[model samples]
Target: MAATKKGNTEQIHDLLYQALETEIGGVGVYTTALTCAVNDDLRKEWQGYLDETKTHKQVLLTVFEELGLDPAAAVPSRKIVKHHADGLVAAMEMAKKGGDPSAAQIVAGECVVLAETKDHQNWELIGLVADKLSGAEAATLKKAYEAVEKDEDHHLYHTMGWTRELWIEALGFPAVLPPPEEVKKVETAIGASRAEHARDDMLKHPR
Candidate 1:
């Protein structure tokens, strides 16, 4: 385990190295967004942001290279990983013990919804931060991540709308679910019903 930890330290060095690379990679995503953007306002805004991210990548990469770290090393934080694994196990165990498939489904749905909400909120927060930025640090984050602001907004808007459509389609329930027992049975039967519909929707529309 000590040896693994040592290796992870080495890997950690690599991951930071790769994190800079990831920043470098982000430029392309931003640039693509800039090119594909139809709105002039977005084009300039996205391009400005990509340019900033590219500069950030270059600066950090130079610093990493100066520090003698391998530019492509991997880093692992065992503690954090173990904690996450434990949390997942505990959550699953709780769900299983509760024996409520509707709750499980709701949990899954909320995770997705919460993640999307966070992404949307991040844009507003970042944009607010950008308003207060100045000098090199400000320029670095704003210009580089500028596209990110737009991307974040786009992501939240499009995903929220798409998920809303999907949510409505998937769950047009009249109001309350059936009793828990029936809910569990129906949840268990979802896959079977989907398959039946695929086999013949007309025959199973009300099934």
Candidate 2:
């Protein structure tokens, strides 16, 4: 879409809200998973990741301010993050429930899928925005988006790959797919949270 300066600003505003939702959802998942992780290393991996996502949130909010919005008052709004996080949590739960290598592998596969999907989604959104945005502003947002997307790609290709192999070695195959209803529940909860949070962020960062 050809964007006028005003249209570009509005589009970016909408995207920032989406980004906020994602950051919160990611943070929530990491915090929750930290409570149940069996390995110190896994806990560390996610902990560091949460910090990265938090940084992304701050940068995007700042970008909003540069665009002339009151960023501190603005809420971040990436609802998809919750759904993605829920998938990871469900995988962890699956590992505990079956106590079998195959089940664990299956769960790990799910995590890989989630991570990969996140990488693609964020890259595309930010890249598109970069294309539409001008000069230093576009460069700023694209670089930030690339950083987070790269982290997710690493998790998908490395952490999740090892996890899947471990499952194959133990169970010969994956054990289960997440139930649709469970996913639906998470979507509803996170989506509601996103709406409320977006309103809060806008209030804090007013246009």
Candidate 3:
């Protein structure tokens, strides 16, 4: 039993370390993404997300303090996480340098979606881990998860909607700008799907 518990705790520590690195990479991703954003609304939205990503980093730092982990400790998984993040940033940069603002915007959206996918999954796992833990550890993780959960959902789902709509528009369809997901403020997978399905109606009604 003791061995099992130690293994679980070690695994949780690795996750937290990766989560911290994800947020750090997220900040860079959003910052670069903003440069590629042509739509005023998308730019505004990403700016907000950038600020929130910064806050999420701070949240993880606090979690490390409470859990007696080193926020800056060298972890093997963290190096891989940073590599992925840096690659995302580089992709956006390459797209931006291609000299097509619209194409770059789409590429940026794709990168954001990829980064947010990881971010959302990390928080989801954290929530699950928190449910299994008890005492101070559980409380700390729960607070961190709760604080960032909604934002992670919004970041992933809404960006997905944006990326899909942008692709539709690029394909020369009459795509709805800002997407139904943004207008409806979707925060769940189901809600995002529903909003996406309703896009035809949104284009027709144009509210």
Candidate 4:
């Protein structure tokens, strides 16, 4: 029984380490995306996300310390996450080197949304598994999840909005300036879906 519990704790620690690495990558993604952003609004938004991502990395490190896990631990999952992030970074750099600034901005938006997709799911799964933990361990995971979940949601949904809108504009379709999510202050799954659909319809109708 003790061995089984130890194995489980090790698994959780591994996952947390991966998540910490992902957050570190998220900061890089946001920083690069901010540089590619052509619109002032989008640049400001990415900057805010970059700040949040930095804080998230620190928060994960705190969780590792709380669990007596080594924050410097190298794991396969972290390597995978790092590889994906590096690919995105390289893609952004490629786009930037080209002459079309608008296209580069669109590329950056897409890359950010892709990285945030994984980053968001990581936290959501952590939140779910946190229920299986007990005592101070559970408390630590739950606190970290609560602290960062909303920011993760904003990062994914907001960047998805930016990606779609930028692509629409690039294709000569009318795009939402700030996106409905921003205007409506969407914070829930239902709200995000509604905002997304509404933005799509607006693009299709194009008044």
Best by TM-score: 3
Model 3: per-residue Cα lDDT over 3-72, one tens digit each:
6543478889999999999999999999999999999999999999999999999999999999899998
Q: Whole-model Cα lDDT per candidate? A: 0.41, 0.55, 0.94, 0.85
| Runs off by more than 4 Å, candidate 2 | 1-12, 70-116, 146-149, 172-207
Query: Alpha-carbon error at 179 in model 2, in Å?
Result: 27
All candidates' TM-scores?
0.34, 0.57, 0.97, 0.91
- Give the number of the best model, judged by lDDT: 3
Candidate 1 versus the native: TM-score?
Answer: 0.34
Better of 1 and 2 by TM-score: 2
| Alpha carbon lDDT at 114, candidate 2 | 63
Clash tally, candidates in order: 11, 18, 0, 0
lDDT digits (tens) for residues 1-207 of candidate 1: 656422343433443444454444445444433433333443454465467556655655554555465555434443343343344334534554566544443333333333334434533443454455445434544553465554444333332332333344348632211212122222123432443234233224323
Query: What CA RMSD would candidate 4 show?
Result: 2.6
lDDT of 4: 0.85
Give candidate 1's error at residue 83 in angstroms: 7.8
Residue 72 alpha-carbon offset, candidate 2, angstroms: 8.1
Candidate 4, poorest ten consecutive residues by summed lDDT: 2-11
RMSD of each: 17.3, 15.2, 1.3, 2.6
Candidate 3: residue 11 Cα off by (Å): 0.8
